[model samples]
Target: MSNSKKKKMPKGSMETFFKVLRMIGNYRFLLILSIVLAAVTVVLQLYVPILFGNAIDEVVGAHAVDFDRMWYYLSRILVMVIVSSVSTWVMSIINNRMTYRTVQDIRAKAIRHIQELPLSYLDQHSTGDIISRVIADTDILSDGLLLGFTQLFSGIVTIVGTLIFMFSKNVWITLLVIVLTPLSFFVAKFISSHSFQMFRKQSETRGKQTALIEEMIGNQKVVQAFGYEDKASERFAEINEDLKNYSQKAVFYSSLTNPSTRCVNNIIYAGVALVGAFMIPGGFLTVGGLSVLLSYANQYMKPFNDISSVITELQNALACAGRIFELLEEPAEVPEEKKEMGKAAGEVNIEHVSFSYDKSKKLIEDFNFESKPGMRVAIVGPTGCGKTTFINLLMRFYDTDKGDILVDGQPIKNVTRHSLRSNYGMVLQDTWIKSGTVRENICIGKPNATNEEIKEAAKRSHSWEFIRRLPDGLDTVLTEDSLSQGQKQLLCITRVMLCLPPMLILDEATSSIDTRTELQIQEAFDQLMQGRTSFIVAHRLSTIRNADWILVMKDGQIIEQGTHDDLMKEDGFYNHLYNSQFVNVAQ
Candidate 1:
């Protein structure tokens, strides 16, 4: 591992612990009930050893057996045992209910918060990492919390109740137990301190492993196409091995805590026995009292043993909590302005706009442009030359760092994001088709669109012919196997045609279709762009040959702007680019 990656781990903060406590606000009554039941159960259980010791004295130690007294104590013990069993069962029910409910609330809140977070933040983090927090981490927390509530609460009650009984019977032995009690805590603290970082590392490694798996699986086609399946497998193996190592180290350190504490506890038990033996013969304590003291000693240290073992789970829960809180606390997207916009006239103006992914390197700088309504403006450039950035700014997927964009002379930022985006329809190269019927996918552009309107749009986009040939026509369930790449792009175009927005953005929209289909889709696109202002981002010079204006972009600046024929006559960059593709095709 690299040193930078091995930087100091953040301690599990009390703030995170208490914040989780606060999340149980709605389930407070159930939580309190569970605790009360646990405490009562423990108290009732403590009476077992006391009553049994008295019975031992009355039955086994006495010269003449006191049958009545023995029966009386045994009856009370029997009654207490029944009550404790019932209480323990009820407590488990209530505690689990409380834990899962609180966890459900946390998951809901986290998911909602994720939705509101900025696109920039989502782009920077892995989807698998985010999913792990929602699913895996929350499950870990639920387990730890359930264990803490059931075991920790009852354990403390048992320890405190036992100590009081022991002290009343024999102060010397009780004091010794109390003095030696800190040893268990010391062992727990030492082992937990060492293991916490390992648990944190384990969690981080698991997230990375999940991310790699998602990436590889999502791009399995690409990996196989390039014959890189072995390479991908090798990479996954490396991450999986790291997760195993981290998990092993974390488990090893946590395992040390329980056994070490048990060893100390055994010594304490033996010491108490020896002390009680001496005190009994010294005439300081009765035989029955000595027997009760030994039982109390074991009960008192039992809580320490149980808690020591649970410290590992508790620490792991805390580590998971820190990650969850970190995500919850991330800054969300800036609130959109509330101003409503009127019907857009399809005129857009970019005035002195500047932007950069990073501040150190500006990609788009002080750029200016204007498009009158109903103009087909084509933007042509090589990859990474800011064609998409222009579209991003226009759609406000990203805001310009320096200047403003205006639609129909109204500043884009001044209007609500929903209203702004509603005026434009987009069809990108990468088609997004959900697992739904064909009609459902096309109606996404206009949720309330009628069946007649949907079919009309599909017909106009040249997709209805293919849709009718399917087994169930428009009602067929869509999946990856249900359609080809070209067919998917045609469906996307059908969706946009259904909406018929005031402006259109075609970002390599026809790149996936064949030459014949591309020609048909282009004619359909011409009809769609008749009255709406359109921005066409294309590498195929043929797609923009008839554009009213063509902007030749290079390194974020507009190197040339003219009609396609005008640019071709100049025989500059645009001319060479347009001719080069034709030459390659001719050969």
Candidate 2:
């Protein structure tokens, strides 16, 4: 439940590469338009180089200045340049929209998938790791798609167009450039494959760093109180060092793309120049024709160069997307064609129940119990006993391995979880407060609760005094430190008081409050529990003395069960616990 555990990630190259391509499938028309615009830009730009070469042919050094003809080509060149620029600008706009929309779709899907994941999965992973997948990874993926979408099609068209035009000018020089193309690709392939692994490690390391930062920050008070600041800093430094190494290695390998491929590309350019120069004196090629070959050579190799850089971005993008895909691909909660069976009549039966977190170590075995309508059943136990586990089972947070939990004669598994959970008003030893107005937090259990009803519940739970003293009373927005632990617990109690369901589960619900308020709350709960069936898990022995039945648990089994008087008369495990609790309190 500490470090995040996940399935082994696939080496995402062509698989994730194509997955990104498929994201734009819904916008085929825009994609086609972008390609068309790209082709138009490439064609126009390719023609300009030829025009410039012809314009050069119109000029000769000694009375070779043909101003009229040169001006004509220059004017045509100007028009083409403007058109290409405008086309690229508009195409960029289309690319941005498609890229951001695709990223948004992925992020939304990841978040929705999170809601469907089982509690067991979330319990095993950290909050920061999940946040990194949902937010940070998607952002990096967007940058990669933008580069790919803008360059890929244009680069391909430029490569083919340059070769055809170059061949028309001179076959010998064209073949030389063609012969050298594979070398550039081989270099790119070698570097990109290795860089992909580094980037993947970098993403994983970032997740760890993010997880650690959030954990330490969220529990800084505890860390300081426990005098663990130095150790915490040391742990953070180790993760940060790993992050630095991975990032540097990823950047170093990815950076190799440009210089390595450019080295190959530059050789191809020089080869074309050398071959064309030798052809000039043989009357096999003119000066203008040689310039055309040079231009085409650069144009043809430019795509490979651009793509090499894009490969680095693509590697990083794929790495992040791979992490996001892992989360999306996780198996969701078992889907059932559920019926929302609303409130229960407070009749619960647990039959032949056996459970464990691990199969080798059984926690609860062969347990059987029944609570009739309006029964106040108290579960008391030592720290390692199955008290909290019992509450989780009853709430269907985790299902039993060997038996059934029934409410109102219907199995909980058969009903929709929302409806089943709605049947009980539950408060735990751990209090939770979400961001919202004070009124909203109280009414979370009963959203449409009236003002008078909220005030009444708050007053009964002894939380109304703090509520009244606040700046805006019920309308005041609640922040993390806005309420004390006791105040937060009081609000949690108030929520249950407002709901007042037919069944209740209170697990150490008043542990944080002072003794005076606990007594006041007990009096209020006495009135509230008049006809409702309740399950109370408490460590303080005196508080549950009035319970209809008390079960003393040890390991996972009930060692003693009876009313307070009955258990004392038996003088067994329950009596020992009761006597020890009073002795410790006296000390």
Candidate 3:
């Protein structure tokens, strides 16, 4: 990937956030209600300062302070305060509910989109970073939308109402305050632009740190074996330092806005005082008018400073939004309109297939193969001879660069991926046992399988004996306290057996088991393969000795292919591999 590519993220593209908002179109009533409540609150708040100015002017003008009038003004101010407080509380409640629903919708859509992404996407990106983008980045928008939008709506309303009252009292002072407003805005914009880049850098660095930690923890055994604790710690520290530096730069720029705005506000206040002093002598400004102007100045400047602070937070949310959109925009692995294959017979065909991980280095070239409905086909190869790649291609985990693969004479490209995969059972070289009961693991392959069915499958895989020996039998939990590697492999085999797929692919399924276990499992496998089309990719020549057909592979081509006896008589690659294995056994 290029540096430019790494730095670039989807921006202002019609994102899921907007889609979520559109979906809430039916909730317009709640939204409008909140806005009305906020507006009412702001209008009421504006009256408090006006009332304060009126009361001040009345006393200063030597008007007899009537108790009834004084009580009336005080009561009116108190009523407005109560109304504003109640309305604000209501609006906040509604806003929070809307935000919760919106975030839930976003999470659901994002998760579904992630499921549609290609296997290659998962391979290229770290699990932790992807999770962080989905969980953490989405949360930024969720929390920001809740608080930021509410404050923004109310602030704008309050500022506008406050300005109107200030202009009514004394237009000149309001004009002066407006001039200072632009300066504050310009300074804020400058800070925001730099802060945005720093925030983006910070998020990216954090993602890298998350990926590194996940890699270290996932490979703890390798790290311990190699004594790489110091090296890993150094790498983590370097990423941490980069995160700290970027975060500081972002916060430093954000912090400058408040002090800068305050200095400008103070200067404006001084100008207002000087102008008011001159005007008061000429009867152009009243004492009450000056009071109102001062109140408005404070009101306007406070929110302006607040808005400046919020600009940085908005930028941070946008940076997070950009990362999330990147994942949502990734191309899906399989298109949705392909035909679903209900069931498949055992026939498989690979015709003129060619492929490569990187286009520059081809791994399979013009490969062709055909398997009958119930034949046992064993693939023999040295390491890196494209055996696994063939299986992956047949499984459609990847698309071939050239030609086509077909099952039961139907082109694989036209079939739904889910349906195509449902027809095969695969036991890979690296078996994984999830933390669960033995029965749960087996039933995963066939969710509706009965206990009797599960037990029968386990017997077929030679896994039932060990399962029965456990304290809980089929219900026994496979955990660090219970299972071994051989036991895990047996359970994996039992899981595949439960699926009972028409076609089976065993890629070194017995490689991790002991000789005695292998012999036992081999007997079970012999019974299981009776009527199924079986594809075996194995390194052990002994495993394929009884196979109906064996193909010796090299590079991207089959070097020799025949029955084991025929290959042995020919004395070629297959013969050489067989002899080498025998020599090892003798040694």
Candidate 4:
């Protein structure tokens, strides 16, 4: 019963890293080309120090200056500079193209995988967290990959090339630089590992904060109505502060890797200068050889700084990749062979159905029921009494744990979900209206609905009056903010009316509108319900008094079921609910 949240490091971080590398496998040709270009640039870069050192030897010791030799080396250096710059530019272009395309493939796969995931996964996670993985996490990974190409790869080439040139000048100096290399790596390794953990924590905290912001903004109306604005703001502030602290610590630790490695390089530089001064007295090395050794020494240490910085970026990229991989690994909905259910006969049977969100608490146990074609069945139950769960089962949003749902004598599981859901039209208590023209919103389910058909459906639902009063009639743009709650409910009803499916589900569809509007809309609903098998979950008992069958459910069991009058005569749970509402209305 403790309320503490556990911090979970993404499982299989290395495995996830390899999976992302495989995503880039398709673009290996471009990656190899970039490496070749980078190698050419590093060769030209390493030659410049050698050319300068030899020119100094030709001019420095003699009384007369060797201007001709100096000029020749300078011209060669200029040519190398231009070629190196062009090669570097070309490599950058190739690397960026490869990185972005790889990220594009990953994001598309994640989105497609999301479609195959079960609704249970979405219900457990937040909308903003899912969006963060798609947008923010992918971008972070790409940035890190790009840094690898620009800095990490090129640094390794420069370091190895510098070592080769250094050894040719003098073995003793080369050995000195080699011995100090491990010290630089030791410093980098110690600092970057600490930074990696901080970065991972920072990424997780960001996802949590983003989810909170989306939830608070989406429910601002309820927050204000309940006078909880201060509480909401305080909650947001707490998460925001947590993110700030985590980000600061991650950046601070990552920043230390560069300077710490550079410090080791500086100490090695002083050691080399002292050792070379002694070698010069014995004529063991020439002035030019000593100068070349010093230049190569600086070149060797530069990569350590570059690599330490790249390590930070690599850690961030891996953390984000871990999140993306986790999303891709989610268990998809059970795949079944597509079975065409041509046209449903609208007969439904719940045969000994049992279900539970949690195994310890059974929500629906051995529920059994049957409805004939074209029967209007009204299901009455108190809140939390498995009302919506019943509709969810029929639509195949969820499969029962132990029993089968049958439509037209065929198990629903055998039918393709797309074709099965298409045969039924639904209007829930919560209305969903996208930002578009009124015509578009009403015809979403039936895209080919004509203007005449749209107007006819709207008129039947009594929604046309308000829609026509708008500036452009059917063409007028309507967002959720533009329409009243009742008008949105009417539009939802109009959509079902337009589809005219053989089976319909209305879950408290008229709960938002006023009494007069409800009565008007109910008349339209009555007309629309003809010849259609409809299942209605209603709290207002009066609206369903004329249903062919009334099912009174309590605590996941159907205690009484018959025509409305028959249930009333029994004076059971349904009678008590109906009489209570009547008494409330009279008062």
Candidate 5:
């Protein structure tokens, strides 16, 4: 198993625990009511043991029994039993409601935070890992919280109330119980503190396992086609084994809390019995009182036992919560400016822009470019040569580390992100199709677009023919069988066509469509770009032959910028890159 990252793990878990407490505290009325009910129930339950001890004292002998006193104590015990039962039930309901609502708020907050998280954060983390936090981790927390509230409050009340009752019977035995009590806490503390890290490791492994399962299942076809089943199984087994080991260790350590504390509890009970037996002859304690002391001793230690066991589950919950707080505390994309950008002129200027995903590895550096209004600027480069990175800069998906990007003579950062992005239409090679009707997907950009407008956009993008064949036409719900790859890309293009913003970005937009459809889509794109400035990122040299200007990029720098014919005439790097495709095609 791979060794997990190591650091001090105490402060974070403790902080998350208190943070969860504060969240539960939000429902002050319910929490306070639950605690009060727990106290009432535990006190009533504690009183019954006293009544039983008094009843035992009343039965001096079979015939000499004080019938009236015995019956009275028994009746009181029965009433206490019934009332405590009702109070316990009511307390459980409040705890459940409080816990369920708190978990709901946390899950909702995580989702809202995820929406605000930066694209960079999303790109760096796995989707499944994030999903685990919102779903699985929160679920574990819900269980822990419900149990903790019900047991923890009542347990403490049980311990305190029992101590008072025991002291009333005999102070010496009560103090003896108190002196031996720290043994149980010492045992619980040692086990819980050690098991906490194991539980944290278990949660982290579970997240990784979920991520791998999501990835492998989502791409099962590719896995099988590439004959990767054996390798995939081996990798999954490794993770599963790691999870099993961590879980086993966590459970083993946590399980010791019950028996270890039970042993100390027995010692306390025996001490009370032996001490009260010796005191009975001298009138320090009575036989009935000795029984009462024994009962209180049992009651007191039961709370410690139950709470110690619950401590393990609480530890697991706190570990999961730490992961959630980690996500919540991440820096979000906070835009500082809100300048209204209305009716952009489609002019953009980039000056000395530099950026890199990693600090040590430079990707884009000293990139300078300018596009006048209504110009079709095509950027061409091999994979990883910063073509998409340039497009990201253009869209401000990433901000430059140095220099400025100005749109319509206004610094891009000076305007709100929503207003800045609203001015441009984007169609990337990778299409995102939600599980919804075709019309719903197409009209997403233009929510109130009329039927005529939607149909015109779909037809121009050459997707209307496919849409009409669906059983429900534009209303067909997209699923695994609903649309093919090319059909999905056409729907994406149909979206941009409906919006028809002031500027356009087409990043291998037609790569999924067939040649005939590509040619038709190109003609449609030409019409779409007629009066708007456009940036076309493409690998097919033929696609950019008529571009007003072509940017030949290599290693994050613009190596050449000219007309296709002019670049071809020069017969340098562009000429060699332009010739290689034909050579590979001939072979």
Candidate 6:
């Protein structure tokens, strides 16, 4: 990463942390109400120790026990407890609903932003990592916001209220208790800082594990065919082990806080006992006062311990939030320009276009091409010769480093990408079929397509016969096992046919299908190509024999140009490619 890019990535987690706080702030009313209720609860709780002390004083001071007053105070405390409990429950419900809603909004926004990003962005990031951020990271925020807020409010209230009541009853004991506060805090902070780093490591490792699983599932066929089960298992085991190690470290550090705080509490208790015993003879403190002071001392350590335990959880949440924010911060691929293409005329002109994936290597140098309306232009090339890159530039999937792509004399850059793409149809070697019916897959191109229109397109693509044989016909659910590669290609072609786009780009559309299926799809493709400007990218010389123009590309430059017959007569790169295919067929 460049220094500028590194700087752009959030340097510290402070910004991401504050982002979560702001999201939680959306439910400010609930949080404020929770705080008020929690404060009242803590204030009422303090009276428990005071009430015990007063009851003890009554019994010891040779006075008749004030049972009526005792019952009144106890009844008030019980009522406060019930109200506080109800309020806390209400606060919890509101907090959880708000957290879930906020996370949902964040996920939805991330998904929408991801869709707007260019294909190049997806090509760069691992699918697993993106999925992890969207799913797992958002989940982290839920628990973090829930526990963090609950503990934070409750802890602060308890600590403050306990300290105030302790000081009011006795000064020396309060000072002794306050003296141990820093020690507990220091211990919690030490554990928190270390555990935070470990939790971040663990979260990142988990994302990698998720990515590995996704990769395996996506390429399950390849793995099984190659007999890579052992290799895949080993890879997963390594990631799993790393996750286990990091998790153990994080948990170990987090687990230390409670016990450490308790040790400090025990030391404070001993100091209070020894100090109070000496002060009792001096008439400075009563037995009941000592008992109240002891209770406050124990209550004071609880918050510190609570903060310590929840800190680990907060660290994990912060790590997840950081990953999610990083994805959300990525620059969008296609900025919404809002300028319409204004009825494209199917005329595409590429002028002196130069391009490269990496800065050190130039793929296309001064490349130029033009297709008049209704021309069947075939781009034939050896693999890795920038055939797909040419189509990508025409579609504005990636911008050319030097030169312009003009559609009907208008610069494509000036028009909105969505409007520009709406005018063209594309089919790739790999067909994508989502989990839906065959009809749904075909109508994906034009969702509002009529039944007649869909069937007509299917018939033209030669898919209607297979679709009819299925149990549900058009409604037959499409799955990997339900359709052959050729069938899927035909479905994709039918989808494009439904769109009736002004132009079409076919990238090895029939490459995976058998000769019989290819011929059937090719016939349909030829019909679809009529009266539409088409760009055919294919390795098979036989498919593009009748093209109006054949451009032989090598290393992103046109090495030869003409119809197939003309190229054969010229006996150049095109001739070489055509001859090689014939030799393979003969053998």
Considering every candidate listed, which one attains the maximal TM-score? 5
Which segments of candidate 3 are over 4 A away from where they belong? 1-30, 60-63, 140-143, 310-313, 469-482, 582-587
Please, what is the whole-model Cα lDDT of each candidate in the order they appear? 0.87, 0.89, 0.81, 0.86, 0.89, 0.84
RMSD per prediction, one decimal? 3.0, 2.6, 3.0, 2.9, 2.6, 2.6
Query: For candidate 4, lDDT tens digit of each residue in 1-587?
Result: 11112234465445766787788888999978987998899989989888888787777656877899989998999999999999999999998999999999999999999999987678778898998888888999999888876886688889889889888888888898899889987887677767777777777777887888888899988989999999988988988888788778878888898888889999888888889989998999877777878887888887787867677777778878888888898879898797878778799998999987666678988899999999999999899999998998889888898889999999999988988898898999999999889888999999999999999999999999999999999999986588899999999999999998989999999999999989998898888788888999999898999899988888888888999999999998888988998796699
**Model 1 lDDT, residue 4, Cα:** 17
TM-score of every candidate: 0.92, 0.93, 0.91, 0.92, 0.95, 0.92
Model 6 worst lDDT run, 10 consecutive residues:
2-11
Reference-based lDDT, residue 326, model 1: 74
Please write out the lDDT profile of model 3 over residues 1-587, one tens digit for every residue.
Answer: 53213544445423533644564565788878877898898888877888877676656445566666666778889999999999999999988887777668767878999888877678778888888788887788777677665777787887788789878888888888777777777777687778777877887787889889989998898999999999999999999999999999988887887788788878887888888888988999878778777777777776776766676666676677778777777878767598898777888888999987767677889888888887889998899999998888889888888999999999889988889888888898787877888888888778899988998998888888889999999887778648877888888899888888888899999988999989988888887787788899988888888888887888988888889999999988888888897886699
For 1-587, candidate 2 gives per-residue lDDT tens digits of 32234356575677778777887787888889888888889999999989999899998898769999999999999999999999899889998898999999999889999998977778878899999988888999999999988888889889988988888888878888888889988888899889999899888888888899899999999999999999999999998899899888888998899899999998998988898899999999999999988888889988888988777788889999888888888888788699998767888998888988666677998788888888899999899899998988888888888889889888898988778888889988889999999999999989999999999999999999999999999999999999999999999999999998888998999999999999999999888887888999999889999999898888888788889999999989889888997786699
Q: Which pairs clash inside model 6?
A: 117-333, 118-333
Worst 10 residues of 4 by lDDT: 1-10
* Residue-by-residue lDDT tens digits, candidate 1, 1-587: 43213334464646667877888768878878877998889888777888988898886644789999999999999999999999999999998898999889889989999988866677778999998888888889898888777777788788889988887888888889889888988888788877888888887888888888888889889989999999888988998898899888888999898899999899889999898888887799877877788777778888877877787788788778777877787777788757987779999999999987766677988889999999999999888889998998899888889988999998898898889888899999999999999989999869899989999999999999999999999899998778999899999999999999999999999999999988988999999999899999999888899899899898888889999889989999999988998896799
Score residue 447 of candidate 4 by CA lDDT.
93
Better of 4 and 6 by lDDT: 4
* Candidate 2, superposed: residue stretches over 4 Å from native: 1-6, 64-66, 167-176, 278-285, 310-312
lDDT of 6 at 424: 90
Error of 4 at 494 (Å): 2.0
For candidate 3, give the lDDT of residue 115: 88
Itemize residue pairs with steric clashes in candidate 5: none
Q: How many residue pairs clash in each candidate?
A: 0, 1, 0, 0, 0, 2
lDDT of 4: 0.86
